[model samples]
Target: MHVKFLIIGAGPTGLGAAWRLAGHGENDFLVLERHAHVGGLAASFTDRAGFTWDVGGHVVFSHYGLFDRLLDELLGEAVLRHQRESWIRVAGTFVPYPFQNNIRRLPPELAWECVEGLLAAGRDAAAGVHPDAPAHFRAWIDRVFGPGIARLFMVPYNFKVWAHPAEAMSHRWIGERVSVVDAGRVIKNIIFGADDVAWGPNNTFSFPLRGGTGEIFRRLAARFADRIRLGAAVVSIDPAAKTVCTASGETITYGRLLSTGPLDRLVADQLVGAPPALIEAAGRLKHNGAFIHGLGFDGAPPDSRCWMYFPESDCPFYRVTNFHNYSPFNTPDPDGMRPRLRALMTETSFSGYKPEDPATLLDRTVAGLAATTLTAPDDAGRLVSTWEMAVDYAYPIPCLERDAALGLIQPALEAMGIFSRGRFGGWKYEVGNMDHSLMQGVEWADRMVAGSRETVYTL
Candidate 1:
């Protein structure tokens, strides 16, 4: 079989590309997804007990006008708007999101320690004590937040989320993703006892009223259902011949290939006759796996916060979302008129540097939730359903070697008429949001159809 454009993986990127191609009246494109279902990591599932859970915590907020319009067109009135009420759990209390901005909620001594550290950081900056740019994320944390906030929140919380040591990762990936706080702002908030919760781009987001976050992508994929082939995993790609072979023994020759799979796997395992340098570069690309737990309880949600970040070891998971709050239908309540269940979605990241025993993760997660005051000890008995999924290629680590690896691998593949984009494909955590991932594919389609320059996934 042959096609003008062949897209691997029916995730957000591939779906976006296919949608754009069809929108532009181009029909000679095909999408091959290894999974039977679409939406990739953004997919949602309804447990037998009737709780809907996303692969992890995902919120619908856009950085592009195209994505905004697309969401409006897809979800319409079926979407719900939410003001982000996120917090950090530390010192036996809840500080508002952007913990640095609202250190006033902490115990007096801890808050003062954070304040002192910020003052010291400010003085150092004024004196030009360390003028050189930070070499890694660790130094960047210390330089920007000072030792107090770094020790109390930034350092530990980051490690929990990334599953990699800060020193091994690059600070360049932190654009709007991280909120940098100053001594003055922190001190002022502490003095006035004010909350500074609206800092990031996702301050206010949208969600599907019925289905979870996956509904957006699921609806988008239906438009070009005939062009998608599920359970057709690619086994090999011969770049010289522009051919792709699936595990089902079908060889497809394509004019141009768009791969949304992990860039490392594409170069190291799938691509035929790759050079030593490219293979070595692929080996350097780092990523962490995620263990998501969708715990359903026989009561209303325990908190009003949308999600809470856990920095201390009291919890095995880095973050927990009040899943039921996102949508009433997320719980098993048949009528949706009166809610009776609480859905807690927790995400724990693991990597070579930080390994977790999945066998006992559920018990630990339940105990941790109670310990952290997310649920009462007796609430474990109230747990009616437990849904868990482990994603091997979860967050693409922005390591010191990432850009260098991408620099070599991306160009080499592009030279062979293969383009890799999306989260793992581009390996850029900064632009790995849902909107960014979809736009990367849309931009790729634009480039293919109109000779437009691709901006989101550029080297």
Candidate 2:
């Protein structure tokens, strides 16, 4: 079949492009999703017992006005807006988020170190002395938050998440991600006790009323049902001929292509006529794998906080979401009041199967939870319901070779009028959030449809 636009991958990025293209009403498009469903990592699943789990954890926070508008239009005003309450796992205590800002909550010595570092940073700044060159992620952290905070929170916490040392990563990608407190303000706050809750874009955000993030994409696909083809995996793309071959052996032709597949896989394996440099660059793109362990409980909520960060090495996951806190729909009935049973007490569960005894997994998760200080001992063994989830592509690692690699790859595709884009697509962790990814798709579509340049690409 021939169409004006052929979109590969039905994830949020692909869905967003399809949504915008259909809304534009000026093009005939077809969306081919490798998965049977539309929502990619943000997809949800319902158990026979009625528990729901989102892929890893997804929260909707927009960096663009257009993304915000699209979500509001699609999900509507009934969506729940939540004030984010997140924490960091530190020295066996749950410190408030942006942990560098809350050093006072840490032990006396660590707090003092953080305060002293702030003071030193102030003196250094006053003398107009800054690092002439920040060559690594560690240096970047030090420059932005000072040595004490970096050592205490940023470095260790980030280490847990990325599973790679800070010194090995690049500093150029950390511009707006890490908060750089004014030296005087940080010290003054330490002395007089000021809280830095209003520090990031995710301080406040929205969640769906009926489901987790998957609901948003499911609805987006619903609106453009005729153009969407789920369970139809695009196995190959011959860009020179503008054709896509699917897993089921169906062939499709298109006038223009918008792909949201992984940068490496798309050009290297899937695209039939990829250029040499694009394949090489795709090979250079590196990402971290994540095994998301979701534990569903049968009792009261664990904490009011939305999610918690882990800097410690004990827990396997760098972050854990109180998925229930996203909405009532995320868990079973709150009023039903089932007793929570604890299952496994270890960080890693080797018993691959879902434990018949729900308490076993819950126990293990709670033990790890307590070990991580994410939960209390009193709350460990009572979970009656339990579940664990895993995702192979939860994180895109910013390896030392990422930029140099993508730099070699992206331009070659661009030269062919193909824009490599999305979380795994553009392969830029600096700009790979849901909003950023979706906007990348929309902006790419705008560029393709109206001869406009993409701002996300420029950024």
Candidate 3:
């Protein structure tokens, strides 16, 4: 079979492209998804005990107006708006999100240490003692946040989340994702005893009222279900013939191909006759996997905070979300009547740099929760249902070699009528959020159908 446009992996990016193409009244496109269901990494699952959980801790927040309008149209009144109440667990206490901004919440001595380090960092900047540009993420953290915050939170927490050493990762991708705090603001907040909690774009976000985050994509996919081919994983791509072969022995020919799978696999494994340099470049692109655990309890939640970060090793998971708070329906009670069930979702990342034993992860996660004071020792007995998902491609690591690698691979693919744009496909963490991923596809479709210039997912 043949088509004008062919999309691989019916995740946010592929769905966005198909949706936009359909909106433009184009009908020659087909979406091929390996999974039987939609939503990709953004998919959700309902456990045996009726608790809903996302692959990871995904909140509905957008930097684009297009995404906002789409959400409004799709979810309508069936959505929940939340003021983000995120915190960090450290130094035997809970510090507000952006741990650098709330050092006062730490123990007095630790707070002073953080303050002193901030003062030292300020002095270094004033004196022009540090380099104009930090070499890597580690240097950037030390230069911007100083030693105390770096040692306590930035270094350890980042290592856990990314599963990569700070020195190996690039610092450039940290725009807006990280909060940069100065000494004066921190000191002033500490003096006033104020909580500097509202610093990021996700301070206020939205969620589906019934299903988990996956509900958004599920509803979108239903619009053109006839065009989507589930369980059809692409096995090979003959770029010269503009043909794709699926695992089911189906051969599809297309004028244009949009690949939302991993860039490395697209180049090194699937594409035919890929140049040696391009294949090597693809190999250099790094990524980490994630283990998501959804733990359901038979009692009320332990806290009011939306999610909490753990920099310490007491918890195998780097972050935990009070999933029940995202939506009451996330628990067993759809009517919001029974406040007895608690849903806690945890995310732990792993890569070659950091290995985890999946066999022992669940037990360690439960023990870690108690060790971090998220639950009591006896609460383990109250655990009614537990669900876990291991994602192979979770976060795309922004390593030092990423840009150079993309530089080599993306252009070659585009020249051959293949456009790869998404979290793993584009291999850019800065624009890898849900809104950005969808916009990348929309932009790609706009460019394809209307000669519109693509802005997001540019090399």
Provide the global lDDT of candidate 2 against the true structure. Answer: 0.72
Error of 1 at 262 (Å): 0.4
lDDT of 2 by residue, 1-459 (tens): 899888888887888888777767845988888777888877877655566777676788988998888788888875888899988878767778778777767888888888778777778767878748767888777766778887767887776666667777887777668777766665566788776777898889899887678888888888888888888977888878878899999999888887787777888888887767667767766665555555655454446778777766665556788777777676667344555322221122122121123344444455667687655666545455555654545566777788888777777766655667788888778788889888888887787778887888552
TM-score of each: 0.99, 0.89, 0.99
| Per-model CA lDDT versus the true structure | 0.92, 0.72, 0.93
Which regions of candidate 1 deviate over 4 angstroms? Answer: 334-339
Q: Write down the RMSD of candidate 3 (Cα, Å).
A: 1.0
- Better model by lDDT: candidate 1 vs candidate 2: 1
TM-score result, candidate 1: 0.99
Report the C-alpha lDDT of model 3 over 1-459, residue by residue, as the tens digit.
999999998889999999999999998999999998899999999988889999999998998999999999999999999999999999888999989999989888999999999999999999999857999999999988889999999999999999999999999999999999899999999999999999999999999998899999999999999999999999999999999999999999999899999999999899999999999999899999999999998875547889999999888999999998899899887665655788999999999999999999999999999999888889999999999999999999999999999998898889988999999999999999999999999999999999999888887
TM-score of 2: 0.89
Model 1: per-residue Cα lDDT over 1-459, one tens digit each: 999999999999999999999989999999999998999999999989889999999999998999999999998899899999999999899889999999999999999999998899889989999889999999989888888899989999999999999999999999898999889999899889899999999999999998898888889999999999999999999999999999999999999899999999999899999999999999999999999999998865546789999999998999999998898888878465654778999999999888999999999999999999999878888888999999998999999999999889888889999999998888898888999999999999999999999988877
The better candidate by TM-score, 2 or 3, is: 3
lDDT, model 3, position 334 = 60
TM-score of 3: 0.99
- Per-prediction backbone clash count: 0, 21, 0
